[model samples]
Structure formats: structure tokens, C-alpha cells
Target: MTRDLKALLASDQTALGTWTQMVAPELVDLIGLNGFRFTIIDCQHGPFGIETAENLARAADANDIAVALRVSRNDPVEIMKALDAGIRHVVVPNIETAEEAETAVAATRFGPHGLRGACPCCRSGGHFIRNWDSYVTAEEARTGAIALVETEEGRRNIEAICATSGLAALMIGPFDLSVSMGLNGDWRCDEVQRAVTEMARAGTSAGLPVIMPVFAPTPAECRDLVDHWRGEDVTTFVVGSDKILIAEAFASWAAKLS
Candidate 1:
């Protein structure tokens, strides 16, 4: 699965996926079966607890799709819990320094590099092996981490953040990044564009893949933005959220009725 994401990132392929606050396993199964390369469980803004997140992860796994989580904060407990729930990849928001990035990596990794609390009985550890040595080695190899470059602080420290080893990729949070640039929701501002471009370059230099979230004003606009980003060599594009799809469909039907 990591190989697949890496391939998409390397070749700049358009990976279509959605963000969900709803942690229902059925929804996860539906999305995964539909051939999404990945599904990001938005634990930060969504009402997902550890149990629900785990269920979603299991559902995705059953369908052979990668299940990733976006943490609410850069807290160790939050990062550790997500990893233990069988989420192979985690996207941490608002990372501002190499130290924070290091902390995140440590929380997700096993001994030698990180201090992630040991849990032999957890699903991640294959259910509490009596022999500790084998479990630790396996855990370290499976987990992956991603740092979000959202705020101006994170953007300014892009090179440092990307320089951290064990990080899988750097993701751009369009809304947050736009606000951080003082554009206040204006994603088209020249400053926002320049910052994203710069960050993409930084990711390339650091040997990390860059991911961008596209919340377009319209479906046509979404396709256009995807094309533009693909041209720039951004392989992973999170197209839209479930909320947007529902609201747009409902509004369109309502307009037709009216």
C-alpha cells in the first residue's frame, strides 16, 4: 500500500479520495470498495473516537484500501492511538518545527527512535507476542507518518520539517494555508500560490512527496485544479469531502424543484 502511494506521488498521478468525519464502518466499506486509493478519517474535526476509527480502519483493510487518519492535534496520545488502531499512515496538522515532527515520528515508531508506549496485545503488535524482540521490529517497519504544512509557521520551516527522516510525505491544507498567508479563505491569492509552489519544491528536494487538498467552488473548477496540480507534479489530490457532495446534490435538486 505504501508502495502504491509512493508510486502515485512519484509519478504525479491523480489519486481520487474523500475526507470523512463520519466514522461509520459501512461508509468506509462503501468508499473503499469504490476503488479509492485511500480514505482519510478526519479525527480532528470529525466525531471519531478510537473505537470508531479502528472500525473504519478495519473496514478499509478488508477492502484492500489504505486507511489514514488526520489527528486533531500533534499530541502523542492522539498519534499513538491512531497508529495502534491499525492506521498505517497518519497526517498531523500544523507541524511547525523539526522537534514537533520528530515527536510525531517517535510516537508512531517503536524503540531506538521513538518512545511509543509498548502494547503487545494491540492489533498493531499482532496481539502481544511473548517474545518482545520480534514484535518491535515488525511494528517499526509497518507504520508511516505525514506532516501537514498548513500555517505560515510550518510553511516557513518547510525545509526543516521535510528534512526529518521516517516521515512519509508533506501535505498542504489549502484552507488553513490560505488563512495563514493572510488571504483569509482566498485560495487564489498570488501569495498562497507562491507558498504552495515553494513547499512542493521543498518536498521534492527533501525526497518527500507533496499532497494538496482541493476544495473547488464547482465540479468543473475541481477538475481544472486537479489538472493544474498534476501538471505541477503533485500526484496525490484529495478531491472533496462527503459534506460537499451531499450539500451540492441537495442544493441542485432543490433549485430544480424551485
Candidate 2:
């Protein structure tokens, strides 16, 4: 059976994913092969462009792993391009209001339901026009947009953001959220923790999945952090980015050589 984010979301399992800034599709295949359930192609902060993201989606499909594209912004064109590239999910960043969340979700749907532009020959439609009806239905059932709320204003309006219609998930952007609150990017501070708890609570109250990153450098620390967030109702965790993981490994190896 094909792996799908929808299945993961509906299940009670703790889904794990990684973020990649590198533009190589092989990295995505490796992520899946290494047992990650999903990978977010980090176009917002990473170096991914439309073409590269499309290629990454192909790799994810080959590996039977769920993939989400974090668009550079919550623009309709960006969302539409990600979808056309065959990515089934989008993570929209910096949403501070229910209206913004609504806009992001709306870009993922078609007519009467959304403002997404239609393309019968897009990669999402199998690059053909023969099965348009089934394609539309499948897209409606499978595709969704996640809201990344990570600012003081966003924290204040998280409940409303989670209340937005058709939002697939709520992700707490810890570093940005801390910095936005004048904490100097200290995601470990109490203020940031409280805000994250509140956001997770709001997400649960709204019946949405909550996702947060566990940036701890050690396996023990990562486990502790996951346990901490799990207590707050966070269902998904992104352990680290490709760059961070590689850099850390390189440093550890160099230390051993010394």
C-alpha cells in the first residue's frame, strides 16, 4: 500500500519527519529508507525551488513516503505550483490569523471550494487529461495545507487559526516564535514552552494535529523533548534538518579523529 500523510494523521501513531534544505532527491529517498514517515521539502528556509521540489516528490513517491512542501510564502501561486509538482501537502509559514490560514487552505482546493488554478496535464494529474474526475476527487481527499504559526501575534491568535476550515495541521515554529516574543531565539525558555503548550492545546481543542520540531542534539535529549511535547498533545515531531544532522556528524567524527 502507498504511504499517505492522511493515513498517518488519522492513526494514533507518533509520526516522525525530517526537514531538508539540500536540493537532492536522493536525500529524500534516504530519509524514507532510514525509516522516516515523511519529509518536508523546506523551500521556505531551504534552497528548494519548484523544479527541485518536484523532483524530490518523485523520489518520495518511489520510496513510498509522505512528502510536504513548505512553500516560500502563503501565496496561491506557490501553493498551486507545489501541488502541480505532485506534492500532496503544503506547509504555509507565518500565518498569524484565521484569515491567513483560510487563505492558505483555500489555495489547495478547486472551484466553489478554493482558488487553486486547474491544470489537467500537471504532474499531480499523471501528466494527462484522461482521468480528471478521479484526479480531482483523489486530490480533494489526499491533499491538504498545514499552517506554521510562529509569531507573538500568531500565538495570540492560534485558537482562531486552528479553527480555520480545512486546515490539516498546526505546526509551532519554535525558534521564530521565541524570537518574535523577544526571547532571542531561545526555544527552551519557559515563555516559549508555555506558548507551545497553548498552541498545542488550541490545536487539540480544534481537532487538528500539532507538529513541532525536536532540535536536541542527543538521542536522549530528543527522546525527552518528544516526551515533553507529547504531553502537550503534539502528535508529530521533526527531529532536525539535513544540514544540522550532517554538520553535527561531521563535528563528532572530527572530534574522534583528534
Candidate 3:
């Protein structure tokens, strides 16, 4: 069977994913083969067309890494296209209410699970390899739906959003949240910390893992991030991304040259 993140996280194991902002499917395979259990294609900020995103998803799956498409907005088409293309998990940005969360979750499901349009011809559904019943059931079993609540309104509605059904995780877009609170880039402010902890607590209360992003550039920093979130109970995040890794490597090379 293909690697499934929802299945893995169900066992209380950490689900480690990398974010891709560039259009390279090779990076997905490289990170997947190395250690990352999943990849989140950044359609929101990245220059990703549907074809490229689909190819990226396929490459990650080929390498046994689950794929999560950080979709563009909360639009159903964006979510639908990602799901139709084989991405099993979706992290939606700027969701601020339970109703928005409900819509996002509904887009990921069909019939009793959600109101997603049915079509088995997509690559993710094996290009109609399975019957409708089997496909829907299998997809639902393998899929995870996550909501990114980054604004203060989202912060206030955290509990209700987390409590939404068919929603698997509540994610923090830290920088956006910081900016929303007028803290500039100073995400270490006490207010930011409090908001993050509130999100974690709300997820815990709702029986879901709180998705976090740890932007460490070195082994030591990654370890520090892990230690920092240890008390939060939930364990999963986009640990780092190609941009950070490449930036670190480039800076080291520049230092050597200098």
C-alpha cells in the first residue's frame, strides 16, 4: 500500500513534512527518500500550476512520502484539483471560522463524508482503477484535512474550528499570525506565544493534532524546536523547506568563498 500520513499519525508517531516553493519534483523525491514522511506543495505562495503540482505529488508518492497540498485560498476547485491529482492531505490558509473549516472539510469528502464532486479519472484515484464505492472509501481512509488559522479572528475561533468534524489538524501560520497581531516579524512576543499555545490547547481539546511549522536551519535548531513543542502533546509539522536548506547551504558556501 502507498504511504499514508493519516494512518501514521493515528499511531501517535510524528508526521514530518517538507514544504516546496520551487517547481522541482526531484526535491520531493530527494527529501522523501532522505527522511521526510510527507511534502506540502505550496500552491499558495509557490509558482505551481496544476500540471506541475500533479507531477510533484506523483513523485512524492513514488518515493513513499505522503503528499499534502497547501492549497491556494479556501476555494473548492483548488482543493478538488489537488485531491484529484493524488495529494491526500490539504492545509488551507486563512480559515477563521468553523463554517469555513466545514466547507474545507466538505471539499475533501464525498457523500456522508463531504460534498466533493465525484470523478474517478484523476491520477490520485488510480485513473479510474477502482470502483466508485471503493475509491471514495479508500480516499476517505487515507486523506487528512487541515485548516490554517493565521489571523486574530481565526485565533479567537480556534476552539470552534478545531472542533469541526472531518478536520484532522489545526495549523498555525506563525508569521501571518504575528503580522495580524501587529507584532511585525517578532513572533517571539508573549502575545504570539500565548496565541500559539491557545491553538495547541484547542486542538488537544478537539482531539486533533495541532500542525506547526518549525523553521530551523541546522540540526541543533531542529532539535531545539522539537524540545520546544514537546509539552504540546501533538507532534507534526512542516519541519523545514527547500528554501531554508538551500539558503543555509548557499550562505555556508559564500562564507567559505569570502
Most TM-score-accurate candidate: 2
Worst lDDT 10-window in candidate 1: 1-10
Task: Name the TM-score of candidate 1.
Answer: 0.90
How many clashing pairs in candidate 1? 1
Q: Where is model 2 more than 4 Å wrong at Cα?
A: none
Against the unseen true structure, what C-alpha lDDT does each candidate score?
0.79, 0.87, 0.82
Model 1, 175-250: lDDT tens digits are 8888987889887878888888888889877888888888884789988988887777777877677677667878
* lDDT over C-alpha atoms for residue 149 of model 2: 94
**Candidate 3, 1-258: lDDT as tens digits:** 347767655656677777988898788878888888877889998987778988887788689887788888898788888888878888899999999999999988876667777786987777765678777788887776789999999999988898898897788887789999999967767889898888888888788877788876786877777777766876886777888877888998999999
Instruction: Give the range of the ten consecutive residues with the poorest summed lDDT in model 2.
Output: 1-10
Which scores higher on TM-score, 2 or 3?
Answer: 2
Better of 1 and 3 by lDDT: 3
Model 3 misplaced stretches (Cα beyond 4 Å) = none
Estimate TM-scores for all models.
Answer: 0.90, 0.96, 0.93
The best-first sequence of candidates by TM-score reads 2, 3, 1
- The number of the candidate with the highest lDDT is 2
The residue pairs found clashing in candidate 2 are none
lDDT of residue 87 for candidate 2: 87
